[model samples]
Target: MLDQTIKVELSTTKKQKPNADQLQFGKIFTDHMFIMDYTEGKGWHDPRIVPYQPITLDPSSVVFHYGQTVFEGLKAYVTKEGKVQLFRPEKNMERLNQSNDRMVIPKIDEQFALKALKQLVSIDKDWIPTAEGTSLYIRPFIIATQPFLGVAPSSQYKFMIIMSPVGAYYKEGLNPVKILVENEYVRTVKGGTGTAKTGGNYAASLKAQEISSQKGYSQVLWLDGIEHKYVEEVGSMNIFFKIDGKVVTPELSGSILPGITRDSIIQLLKYWNIPVEERKISIEEIYEAYDKGLLEEAFGTGTAAVISPVGELLWKDRKIVLNNGETGPLSKKLYDTLTGIQYGTVEDPFGWIVTVE
Candidate 1:
């Protein structure tokens, strides 16, 4: 277990908070952040909450060279009754350790991490945006800090938690988005870091993302790395398709991320008695479903966007439109229910909420 005593050092100066109406994703940060250090022999120590500031690192830091890092994202929401809450934060911590294990980083105590997070959020509770579709974005990450150019695991590391107040992740909001299917580059393959929320996986996606953006697409839909035929996931979110009347998402086949939002939606559907399936879904199969008029809706689920409806998908020379290029009813309901539970307006049947009192 991590040391329970966390040293708190309030910031001596504060920056002006951005207006709620003008808030943008990750562009602004709160006044404070939480940090902890890990050493080779001594393990993690010196947990502290201090003013948000940059730290100097050696040019030969392992992170800069080998890219050994992991990160997780979640949000703090202000309820209508003015209560602060988090949705299934323990799951994020669990995934963080999973990523850490994959990257050979030391494990962190999930319970202690949650406690530290709650304290950090409680201290900066004022930064939680109450505007519609707005909340405090929480970023928890770990990086290899050992100043070495070696290819092996670093002897030192830093874990941090930073908060940002932001609006919607996509300018389209709940509106549908256009996706470009990439056949040139793949994100990751099974038995790779694709399942882990690490920087390398996202870094590998930038090329496809850049090209897709140039083509006027909102995001890139990646296919399996090996055959490049099976559907994997979107750049920043997990993809799902509602065919006919049943909901289907790509199965976690070791290459796809296990999204917290994705799991929540699956459970939500089952709770409501809505048919849902998780299995290997191929792009060609999706196109076939669209041809048969079974592809009724498509969407992506992640921490940033919560739920992003897909209106159009471009693959090779074919372009298929879904739900007449508008938000589908199922998409909107999932969004409303998920967001409602997140913001404390809906009854949380799964007990996923963790209050910051």
Candidate 2:
């Protein structure tokens, strides 16, 4: 069993907090962070909150050599009443363990991890941004710390939770963004670490993302690695399409990261009586729908952007515009509802909010 008590140490000198309006994503960090260590025989031990500082690791750490790590992202929102709360943080802990399982890392106690996260957030509650579309981004990650030259899982590990006050993920905020369909460099295939939140999967996408940026695209739309025909997901988010008055997203085919926001949006749509489906969707099919004037809107969902409307999609030599290159009605509604619940303006009927007091 994991330790139930966590040690807290306040920072001696506080860092200057940035203006809420000037905040950028993943830039400014809080004063303190949460950390825990894991050993093969000892298991996880010494849960504590310490002053934010650099961590010293061996040069031959397993993470540097073999890239064995898993991470999760969520947010803490400050309501108008000045209460700090987290949105679906338990889901992030659950997903972290899922990623750990895939990466051959020891499992963490999910409830204890959530407890530690809540404590950390409570200590730095003031860091939660109050500006519109601003929140404290929480990153919980685990890394292999054992010093070894072998190509295997490390015997020691470190699980840490750090936070940063962030503004909107995209400069456009809720506005739509142009996406390029990547045909050459695939993100990942089945039976790979694509489903896991590991660094290697993202490192593989940098080349494609760099090429797409030069083409004036904000993100890349990835296809299945095997056939390279079916739509998988966006670079940083899961994708959804409004076709013929129905919502469609690609099914989890073991090559896609199961996003917590994506699942919530699907559930929200169903609650609102909107038609939604999850299946293998091809790029050709999307184009076919566009040709018939049935493609109405396209959007991406994740912890960062929440809902990123796709204004345009460029697949090969063909391109199609969605909803007149504006945010769609459904997309806006989803964004408003989700954010409202997050910021405590809207009633959370889904019980997704966890208050930190």
Candidate 3:
């Protein structure tokens, strides 16, 4: 547990808030942010809540050179009863620590970190957007600060949490998206930082993302690094496929992100008594399923989109359309149910909702 209480400092001058109806993703930030520092022997100390502003760092920081950084994303929703709540925030915290461990960064007190997050969210509670499908996005990240040119892990680090009020991730709401299977440029190998929420993994995906965007696809469905045949993940989310009335997703093969939303969907499917499988699923298998008319639906799961239904998938020159290029029934049901629980319109039977008091 964190023995130190977070010091609060309010901003004297606040920036003009954006129109909630016109809010975009990650474009605007809240008034205050939470910050904590870590030293080699001192561990983490001096937790504080201060006005959000520019941060200073040295040119030789390891985070810039060696990419010793990690981050987590979650959201705080404004319930129908005018109360602020969080959906599976502890999972994000736990994942953050997991990322930290993988990146050779120091571990954090998960509960205390959550408490700090709650305090920060409480301070910016008004920033939580109230529009339909709008919510306050929270970003917690850590960066190496040691101003040395060495390639080793930094002894100094800074952990910070920031908030952004955003609307829907996709402008078209829960509509389906077109995706391209990336045969070139592997995201990461099984022994790499693919399982970690680090910047380098995302940085390595920019080229493929640009190519996919130029090809008019919304995202790239990545294949396994070794064989380049098995489906690993989507651009930034976990991929799922519905074949012959059964739901299948790629298992956590140490190279795929273990997504919270993905886990929730699995549980939700099981709760509904639907067959869900997590194992190695190859692209050829998907095409075979399509050939047999068993490919029912496809979607991606992540914190940003929650669930992104796939309408079309292009692997090589062969293009396959799912659900007649419309959102599948199961996809719609999952989205509605997930969002309902998030916005407090549906009953949260799994105790996943955490109210921000």
Per-residue CA lDDT of model 2 for 226-284, tens digit only, reads 98899999987999999999999999989999999999999999999999999999999
TM-scores for every candidate against the unseen true structure: 0.98, 0.98, 0.99
- lDDT, candidate 1, 1-357, per-residue tens: 555799999998888988877998898999999999999999999999999999889999999999999999999999989999999999999999999999999999999999999999999999998888899999999999999887999999999999999986655568899999999999999889998999999999999999999999989999998998999898789999999899999999999999999999999999999999999899999999999999999999999889999999999999999999999999999999999999988899999999999
lDDT score at residue 78, model 3, on the 0-100 scale? 93
Q: Report every candidate's CA lDDT.
A: 0.94, 0.93, 0.94
Candidate 1 colliding pairs? none
Segments of candidate 1 deviating more than 4 angstroms? 170-173
lDDT of 3 at 188: 96
Candidate 3 structure quality by residue, lDDT tens digits, 72-190: 99999998789998999999999999999999999999999999999999999989989888899999999999999988989999999999999977666788999999998989989
Least lDDT summed over 10 consecutive residues: which range in candidate 2? 167-176
What's model 1's TM-score? Answer: 0.98
lDDT of 3 at 74: 95
Which of candidates 2 and 3 is the stronger one according to lDDT?
3
